[model samples]
Target: MQTRTHFTTRLAALVVAVAASALGCSAQADQTTDKIKSALVSRLGIDAGDIKGITKTPMAGLYEVNIGTQLLYSDANGDYVFNGDLIDAKNHRNLTQARMDELNKVDFASLPLANAVKVVKGNGSRKMVVFSDPNCPYCHQLESTLKSIDNVTVYTFLYPVLSPDSTAKAKQIWCSTDRAKAWESWMLDRKAPTAAGTCDTAAIDSNLALGQKMNVNGTPTVILADGTRLPGAVSGDRLEKALSSAH
Candidate 1:
């Protein structure tokens, strides 16, 4: 009985030692994170609000910094920062882009579809969302590419950030009797919208704010049904593959 009691006591002490070591390691990690964050703000002139998170990467002494949807890497001291793709050569994977894709994902169900110009092609079975600026040439190019895509419902949020003329055109498109048709006509044929920009166009302003909040820094930002964010104009084949994989 005495031997058993002694073994139990030693086991308890061992468990306590292990737990204390874990706590110490956790405190050290927290301190490292705080030091890195402070250094980034002071030395790099990065906004504290924009620093969403800082985590240690698999590489020794390397840390990953997440700012909005952008991914950056820094040393433990934060003295060195680099912006580029981190590739796992052996596995043939892009770690940085994979993380960005995860960080940029938006919940499809949370989108305000009513505020967007809805375009239905074919049976309109698949769904996607796009943030587009009227005057952005890339957006116009994407619109032409979208013509070949069938069986997809696209929700376009008029994000007028290029110029005042873009805002005016977006207002006219939103005020038009048939928003989808007006958007296609103007985008496809270079025809200006004829509707007076006098209707309730609060949705346009709302879309602008929403785009900013979502970190949509460019035109023709596409979001698939599964919350995959495509930052620029993608080919119809790529869109079809993404749509198929999403379903």
Candidate 2:
């Protein structure tokens, strides 16, 4: 009979052996990464620097590749590549998307709350961060939905990605004496903010860089307390569900 400890040790040995055989050498990780990068560049015509990451998956010989916000898969030697979701048939799970979401998520507390327009409702015990563009129609739609939710503290990052007008509008809103009110007025009441123009608006630039790092290319990207990112303007019911699930 195979004891539990023996089984664990044997499994580890098997994994190591498989990796060694697939990679052809147990060289440094840097070397391995370079080899994979070279293979990807040569075979797939992907720029080596554009490939954000390459890592081994749980399944032997399979590697995960990251290009910007998109995910790809390759064999050990990059001989074959796949650009799609990897589903677990037995567990009925979309592993590829799950991994992508996990990688893209950020610590909610780490966000620069001082830079955001803050709004509190009810007790305001629950917390959420929103990356919004002042010029985005979807952000206006989300603002309408958010008005109905309660007991939450909303931190709105003025992420201006849509147009030059969006950045100008974001700076205008940020420069207002009452940022939250200004944002609400603009997004909900269809009123534009009159720019004070003198307030230091460095936070907007920081938010833009942060959004890029987090792979947030779209407006109205909501981040729940548990680091789950919901892209686009989800419905109020779905938003409630996500909040409850995260809680």
Candidate 3:
């Protein structure tokens, strides 16, 4: 299953909701949004044949509108426009969550796995990837949890963003005797690796740049085999559960 996630919108849903009552009684939210769509077509002088689905959202003044593959919002009365988050102040709910949930999935999978060192357990029957920082407390917690799982292949990218010291520690791990064993040992036993003979190891810098490009701001961002990204530390049992249903 795709994980549900929400984006922070720029406007308040309360404003959209407040504008809903100002709409004509003959106009439903969808119809009102259509009117906005029709107006835009007339103004743009397009054929207006590409319009597909229109729906009313919980947003106060704006309508959550979809046209073919494009997504936008229009005022309840077809007066204004919107292109960002729709926040609900009363319930503290995000109206745009469902839309953004499927947005970043593809780019998540396109990440280069070769930059990450692989760690296999048991028969390697399953696969998951983790972005971790050597010195992050949460990453340590995730490392402990991944220990219990079996028959799984793990690709770990050392994110190393805690501080300057963490970068040094990560460089040592990347240049250690055994990339896999050294990582597991360092993470599980707090056994810091010895000084790397060469200080010019590229793995640390590579992972840092990769993390930045992938929007991995913190450690322990676990991406399942199916390309769905889950951000946070998860338990062993929970990890197993996720694997069971993941592709």
Candidate 4:
């Protein structure tokens, strides 16, 4: 009985030691993260709020710093920081870009579809969303590319950041009776919207805010059904592949 009691006491002590070690490690990690955040904020002149998260990477002593949709790598002490793709030569994978893609993903179901001009192509089986500007040449190019694609529903958010004229054109397009027609007519046919631009176009302002929040610095940003963001003009075939894989 005494031997059993001794063993039980030792086991309890060992468990306690293990738990204390775990707690100590967790506290140390938190401290390290805080130090890194502080160092980055001071060294890079980045807003503390903009530094979303700092996490240890697969590489020893390397940390992944997430700033909005962008990713940067740093040392454990944050003494060194670099912005570039971290490639795994053996696996032929880009870890940094993959993490950025993951971070930039939006919840498709949570989007405000009502704020967009809906255009249905063919049966409109697939879903896509676009942030476009009326004055952006790339947006016009993307509109042309979208014409060759079919069986997709595109929800266009008029994000007029280029100039005041772009905002006016977007307002006109939004106020028109047939928004999709007005947009396509202007984007594809080089014709301007004929609306007096006097309707409740609050959605355009909301879209501008949304775009800013999403870190959308440019027009012609394409979002697939699965919430993968494709910036700039994507080819029709690539878009088709993305659409097919999203399901």
Candidate 5:
């Protein structure tokens, strides 16, 4: 009986090996991906270009669809779609949100830093980018939080999307000879920016265009060193923790 069991196990292993050899793993995966892509375009009526790629998720039968920066999941057959977070049952972690963050990460060095008002504190070893509106109350709140943070460099891009008043205020701050000081003075002290000189305010315009291109729709959008887009006015401690973790 023992010998028969051993022979059966070896036979099963041999059969699996033969099957794997007949159809390579890479080729099998590619075939599945192609089928999903075809289903996305034909059955789902999603544009072929919009369907970036279909990849298997940690859950065996589920697959992730990369649609630009957003992530959506579908069944193995690509019939049903899931639009919510994929949670790990055992670990109690939001795996979908984590994957989305990874996919949506931007390149920190790719930003046009020259157009932004640079403020350095302490050793300035940590770096962060912020899209802020001068007239935004939340931006003012974020500014207050940023003031408490030490050993960091903040690149403030004047993103005036709130109102027309925001644009005027942004222009004034950007046109100032001492932009960094002017920005802090207004945000921290309630001191309005002085009248702008005839100096070229092209940088402000460039910043506006750049902000639009980056799809920054709101003020106080903070980007940490790891290219994580943290929207809204977060507390100083949270911001500091993120900076530390990235480092």
Candidate 6:
């Protein structure tokens, strides 16, 4: 009888342990969800009524929040917020790149490719987008570096800065016989194109508006095919490394 009682006691304990474990998992899920909502409400200044849903990600404890049409993330406690490219270190892969790509997408098809001069190097299979000022020395250096790269098609936006003289030169380039040739002459040969002063050209106005929309506060900003932006003139090898790594 004593042995029977001991067995029953052990069985009861096992059942309690299993119940506690299940409850612990449920509680943790709730806590993380609660934290995510609370963090966004307090820090992001987003109205609680507008919050759609928050889903926990496969990336350990991180969460993916769907706020209307947008996606963002917060910590378990909703204490931290960031934009990050989740990578697979073991495979040297970009895991969250596709999601990030959707998040920061550009309408490549709709871009006024004609307003920007096109440079075709090699077979021009690879594509890149560059925003550059006519008078920016760093932009000139980037142009010089770009000439050496092969099999790449470049779309150059006329982002004039430095002074009023730069804008005038950009206008002249847009009105020149060959926009590509005009840009190269200014950047490579340090020769400014003569201003026919054509107000009809749309390149300067279009580029300026696009730059503002892209939050580009500086010159020589380069965007990769995967929608990832390099804020400055990146090195040739490093640029290739970044561009090729996109999934």
Candidate 6 wrong stretches, greater than 4 Å: 1-102, 242-247
lDDT of 3: 0.73
Kindly report which residue pairs in candidate 5 clash with one another.
Answer: none
Clashing pairs in 4: none
Candidate 5, residue 78: how far the Cα is off, in Å: 3.3
Q: Count clashing residue pairs in model 6.
A: 0
Candidate 2 Cα outliers beyond 4 Å, as residue runs: 1-33
Worst 10 residues of 2 by lDDT: 24-33
Candidate 4 lDDT over residue span 77-170, tens digit each: 8899999889888999999888888988989998899999999999999999999999999999999998899899999999999999999999
TM-score of 4: 0.93
Per-model TM-score on C-alpha atoms: 0.91, 0.84, 0.62, 0.93, 0.77, 0.60
- Prediction-by-prediction clash tally: 0, 0, 6, 0, 0, 0
In the range 4-29, model 3's lDDT, one tens digit per residue, is 33222324565676677666543664
Rank by TM-score (best first): 4, 1, 2, 5, 3, 6
Candidates' C-alpha lDDT: 0.93, 0.88, 0.73, 0.92, 0.85, 0.78
Cα lDDT tens digits, model 1, 56-123, are 88789999999986888998888999999988899999999888888898999999999999999999
lDDT of 4 at 49: 97
Worst 10 residues of 1 by lDDT: 238-247
lDDT of 2 by residue, 167-194 (tens): 8899999999888899999999989999
1-247 in candidate 6: lDDT tens per residue? 4698899999999999999999999898878787789878988898886666777766776787756434677778888776566667888877566554455566566667777888888888777888898888889889888877788888999888679988888889888888788888889998888759586767678889988766677889887776677767788887777656632
